[model samples]
Target: MKPELQLSLQFADARHRGALARHRVARFVRAALETSGRIAVRIVDEDEGRTLNREYRGKDYATNVLTFDYEHEPEVVADLVLCAPVVEREAAEQGVTLEAHYAHLLVHGTLHAQGWDHEDDGEAEAMEARETELLAALGFADPYARG
Candidate 1:
């Protein structure tokens, strides 16, 4: 059975959020989940991103994507935080379009919300493989592929 997705998107940084449309974001997220519940995808500036990372993860800098998994089982529920500046920088560094990078991060965060992790080598490999397949299905290249 296909999962039902309930996505709520918030833009704390409006300047960088419009590059990715709401429908595209939802499509990428839905492709990564096995079953659906609800997800909140918030695009934030460096300040809020750094604050959340420091508060929740002990990191002092703004990261590209942060996934907070609230539930996983009969239904998947979570929040995905994407740092706009970080994402833009990374996209430039990786020589990919902003939309492609957003799609990859959305897929990555959704996987995390569904209880997928890359804590170890084996786990990372499996998770990355799944991500690649899903992205390919969505007409995106492998996000981890070297240039």
Candidate 2:
């Protein structure tokens, strides 16, 4: 189990509510993948999120989360940057708990790092199903369900 999962977290947000458990987020991601490499998650504000997302994805606006899959030869060192404010607002708008939303995003990003693409309907369904199952095991609600 240890050999299959690796994640490193960096909290850079101004607010540390201590309301959400970082480890829950990590475990949520780890439990979904067959990874043997590290995925680093950094909590950032809109400034950093906007810059990084714009630079890499060509989207001028800051997204709720961005996943940068490592393009190396020998190591999988993906980076997942999550905008804290966006997450909070999204949770409220989506009518989900902050922790559940965080879990959904982390797991979503982790799957992206592991080559799970959801550009089409079938792919999206498969990926969402996997996410639902993984989150359920972790005691989180289905992220796509209407409130």
Cα-based RMSD of the predictions, in order? 0.9, 2.1
Each candidate: what lDDT? 0.92, 0.80
lDDT of 1 at 127: 96
| TM-scores of all predicted structures | 0.97, 0.89
lDDT of 2 by residue, 52-112 (tens): 9889989887799898987433545688889998999998999898888888998888888
Stretches of candidate 2 above 4 Å error? Answer: 71-75
Which candidate ranks first by lDDT, i.e. highest? 1
Stretches of model 1 off by over 4 angstroms after superposition: none
Model 1 lDDT at residue 20: 71
Query: Candidate 1: deviation at residue 47, Å?
Result: 0.3
